[model samples]
Target: MKKINQLYTGFALAMMLLMSSCVKDLDQQPYVQETSASVYAKAENYKRVMAKVYASLAVGGQEKGDGNADLSGRAANAYLRIYFNLQELPTDEAVYTWGGGDALNPLQFITWNTTDEWSAAMYYRILYTVGLCNEFLRNATDEKISKFTPAEVAEIQAQRNDVRFIRAVAWSHALDLFGIPPFVTETDPVGAFFPRQIKRPDLFSYVESELKEVAAALPSRTQAEAGRASKGAAFALLAKLYLNAEVYTGTGKYSECVAAANEVIAQGYTLEDTYSKLFNADNDKRTNEIIFAIQQDGMNTTSWGGTTYLVCGPIVGSMNATERGVQSGWSSIRTTPQFVSLFTDVTGTTDRRARFHTDGQSLDINDVTLQTDGYGLTKFTNKTDAGGNGSNYAEGLVDTDFPMLRLADVYLMYAEAVLRGGTGGTATEALGYVNQIRTRAYAGSNAGNISQGDLNLNFILAERGRELFWECTRRTDLIRFGRFTGNTYLWQWKGGVKAGTTVNPRYNVFPIPAADRAANPNLEQNKDY
Candidate 1:
């Protein structure tokens, strides 16, 4: 149930929703015959289109390989891969060794500009997803619902809320990653004038309001599909948005963050006893802990993105492919020395979260471009919790579903919000939540926990790194603490320097892709791009 089988055969329908990708010229479009009249004549088409919306983030295209590349950067075009590259590669937690002709090179060194291809690709990809959601919502209106049976109408209404949740997700990422993104909604006509940009504060308000509205209509965690968004999923996203409210809108909403997190926490999700099991190929079985995950299946949702790259990218040097149960070692991604040092002992640590492979690698990374310069991470693998190979895994592809949000993260958020002066929780309770995470990480070791005094902003930040490494939250966490672009904290190879240097604060938000800005004059670039 967790795996989203590419349920639709009509790839053309998926491409039809991408208004930006339909034309050769950014500002121009060739007339097409497949209008909403033909595509949306039946109500069942709603779910098929919804599949495309989720698939946009799961696989790269209609087919696995080079042909029918749905978006640009083909292999790297998948939403989570580009999102991971932009979010994780540029941060201190991870680095890619591919320096030559790599589109992601700019991100790794923080030398990105408006012309960076990955940035543009991700921007288009997210907007394309939002467009599909808009298209679905537009077709499922009250006038259209009048024709369906009452039961069908009820199902369509529930599906409409699900589409709204997906839209809220894409918009939230856009707001977080691109500052104010070009705005569009179901109310906007399909082929009218171009959409104008919305500022960050306004975008934040939209995401907040949308989540609140949809959360009420969404199914409970138990009732929803494993990959589908639900009340828990909405609560998780709301918690994350409120956690970063200050960064997005210049307002502190830590209290709201705590309340939202508590909402999810009370929704009956518990931590997995084994920390390493969360990233195994069979992670879809760990649905109790995972609120929402981008579904991936080796046999069904095959792509170079998703957990396939996530598992293979970090396996380098002497990391045996057979031992990891994957076909090959991509050997692309590895941890920075700064990140490795966060653990008490890299080699022999009781912390199960310290999942680094040090067999032929050095702990210190003298050069960021060399693969073996830093320790490889074994956090994500094609093996299962029971040390068995994953079913249907082959040729570097995997069945690992990437956890978008988990219960542990919600717990951490609650504690952090409390420390930040949120009203709903006490420091003692916050410390208890932090200890729950540590108890899992430490396993059976005597490393019991810390007192209330140790639960400060700095400790919470470091704890987040330890727990959520490689999960694409590092950049946002660092930004909220004012450590992303300043001298307050430094990682290797930041700001294009071997020894990290302070970068311009303008980099806090990525520049809008040059092509997008050139196409829509109404879209203004972020300052100092």
Candidate 2:
């Protein structure tokens, strides 16, 4: 099994800290010197470089608590839960007041206020990661290390394709978050800069083309490189891109999503049969369901601070041996009643929907006991006590591997894409995929009945919420449907008190962090900042 500590080490921490520091310095660093003659001098050396590129995949800027305390918190207050609040702001779901520190907090009701620092940080992290991949590709040559024979050269090229695939992931992140980003190629000069935003459709086309090229070149499997990106991972990401193509480019790529998903499904991947097994740390690297996860190790040379559970873990009604003993000042995230209502009792006994309550008890909708007006999301529940060190108070250090893609995700993407493409697939046909996951949750057999015509975009969106709760895809899904700006329950409630009931378009994009604006004068702020 791959050790997470060895993969992330102090490097992840250094990268996170440095990303927040300075962007100009990134331009000043020299690329690793390489010549056509000396590149790829050793097969093992090239392998190590490839490994480093894989390692960079785990680096992320959003703190765990940032989502729970702010994004999820804001969303819960809006009467939507599971997906991030990015969707709630525009929908009738949420509203915000202009608090001082982050104007985007309040202005989320009115406009996109993303700052340059936020954009720059995301760009910096991705570019830095892409830089590592490019460095390996640059230095990988047949002559230098002389350690590789002809066969090894073929293998190295395949590894190089994996690096390219990772770079594509970074690019996708940029596109999804920023809409249009500058596409700097490997051949671009190290410090040369470009300041134009490409159109979203144009960027999506580029990403699609790149994934196809790399996926065709990637190996089907590699035992020695188990945690690295595989052909399946490439296909999964391609499927996701295609699934969202209509949203990103205003063009439906549902057929492409099906094709890409089918490719991964053909590779013998399947959903794990148990819901809890999917989250068990010990089963992480072993689960076939996980196509690509940010490999994490709680014990080892490259230790990551546990973040997900720490941030999203339930607050104690009262502290106990099993509960993290922190005072419950910020029980930030809660499930929406809408989401909780979706869970039906398999036994057909008394409805246990009240299990979702913050008070840890069920209540009938009409019962006065439902006064907390909160839904407890058990999906990220962490029962561990805060370690004696008190580090658990901060988020982003969770030991759980943040799953980026999984086999079940691919299956559902295919099912949804096929249904939306006007292809004749039954809810029964789709149920085959959905039931595999539902059965694992022991949530009873699939409803086993849905019609293609019945499979409206909203149905698929809700299905995604049911299956991928708290997986960080909520923001994208909401935006794609134009619901991010709608006034959902949370927005209606909060807006009623704060802004006296108004809708805002700027909430679609986050405000650029203020710190970034001070750093780059050329960086224009997202409108309403």
Candidate 3:
């Protein structure tokens, strides 16, 4: 029997939802022959539209197998796929070796320009998500609520906060990736379809405010419904934002970060004892650790992005794809030796979290085009704990939900914030939190525990990479620690050199995509391209 996760169950009927691509098109007409009045008139369809908002973050489009994408022409427009590229590729954590057609090398090599495809697609994708969320918020008016039953009204009311939370999530990504990005809300003036750009600090405050509001409104719990954003999710996002506050706003908000982490840790989520089980096909059942996730059902909600990319990207033909529960392997993603060096033992015996696949793969990435030059990753898989493939494994689609926010990340944030001079937490507590994660990694033992002297900023940074590898937090983490675009740190191909060299500091925040700039006069590129 499969677990019933209803997060995206209503997405098929959400076709009536309208969306925008960028500043020039705030109200693009629906693809279907449906007017807003005719579509949003009913109360039942509200939930379906909300489902569309959630699906916007996970799937590429409305069509099956990610065909006929929501934003067409570019297959890399999927949120997780592009987000993974921007977050992981430029840093020392991971690399993509595909050539000829896809626009991925610039990401890994740190040479992306204003017209780069991945950044452009990501810009529109985030805005598209905001567009969907705005549409949902636009229709969830009090006037519309009065037309529905009280029970239905209650549900719609709750979703309004969730929608805001989701929108805040998109905006937060903008704040983190692109220092200053165009800002839009449901309350924009009727004619002001062109959104005004917000400063990085202001956008940070806005995101913080949205998270705080939702944190108060939504329930703090052990887990949210498969794809729903909850109070814990809000707190988790808050902690993440505050942890990197100095990078986004030039202000160290470690105390605030600790407070937010405290709230999330209080939500009663325990570590899933078996680390691998937390990311398998049946991860939906591991709600104890995953605070908020984007649901993916193999049979109903099939996608080429999301965990399908994670489970298949690194598994080449030489690797046993069937054992990993997918039909084929892409061999597209691999890690540099710097990342593999974080673990004393790449094998899982000493550290169960060290799940890198090294067979038929070189430990060093001497060439950017050879996938086998870097170590393959196995952090995510399409196999269920019972040793079975996902529901649609034969088709290469998967059921592994993307864990956007989890308890372990919160723990690391809490520990980091404390070590960074946060006031609310003690050193002992920080050490305890790190050891809690270490205990899990060391397979329920204390051998991997760190002493007080070993628990420093350097150790926290490495510990974060070790624990949260392939989780899409690397670039931001490096930027915060001053290691992203300078000579302080080097990986196999950092800044496009085999030995690695310093990159221009302007590369810290990606320039606004030239396509978006050309389309909208209101938008400006980041400080430099």
Best by TM-score: 3
User: lDDT of each model, Cα atoms only?
Assistant: 0.83, 0.53, 0.84
lDDT of 3 at 112: 81
True lDDT of residue 294, candidate 2: 66
Expressed as tens digits, the lDDT of each residue in 1-529 for candidate 1 is 2345644333435456432235566676556656666566766666777777777778777775313677656234678888899889888898888855576778988889998888788888888889878988888998977787888888889888888998998999899899888999999987868798999999999999999999999999899865778899999999999999999988999999999998998889999988888998788888789998887777667778778788888888898887777878887988888998888977536788988889889877787677788899988888877788766655567878889999999989999999888998778888888899998888955485888888899999999999999898998999999999878888888887767889889889999888878889899999998
Ranking by lDDT: 3, 1, 2
User: Candidate 2 residues 292-402, lDDT tens each?
Assistant: 776644332122212243233433232231333232323333333445545564222332112333454332222211223334444432223223312233322334455
lDDT of 2: 0.53
Candidate 2's displacement at residue 509, Å, is 3.8
The parts of candidate 3 lying over 4 Å away from their true place are 1-5, 16-32, 190-192, 222-224
Candidate 1's displacement at residue 212, Å, is 0.4
Q: Rank the candidates by TM-score, best first.
A: 3, 1, 2
Error of 3 at 279 (Å): 1.0
TM-score to true structure, per model? 0.94, 0.71, 0.95
Q: By lDDT, is 1 or 3 better?
A: 3
lDDT of candidate 3 over 1-529, digit per residue (tens): 2333465756756763443222346577554456566667787788788888888887887777665588865533578888888899888888887843576888889988887788778888898899888888888988877888899898899989889998998999989888788888887754546678889999999999989999999965634454577789899999999999999888899999999999988888899998999889888887789988877888877777778888888885368899888877887888899998899999889999888888888888888788788888888889988898889876888988888899999999998999899989989999998999999999999999989999999998999898888889999999899999989999988888999988999999988877767767888777857
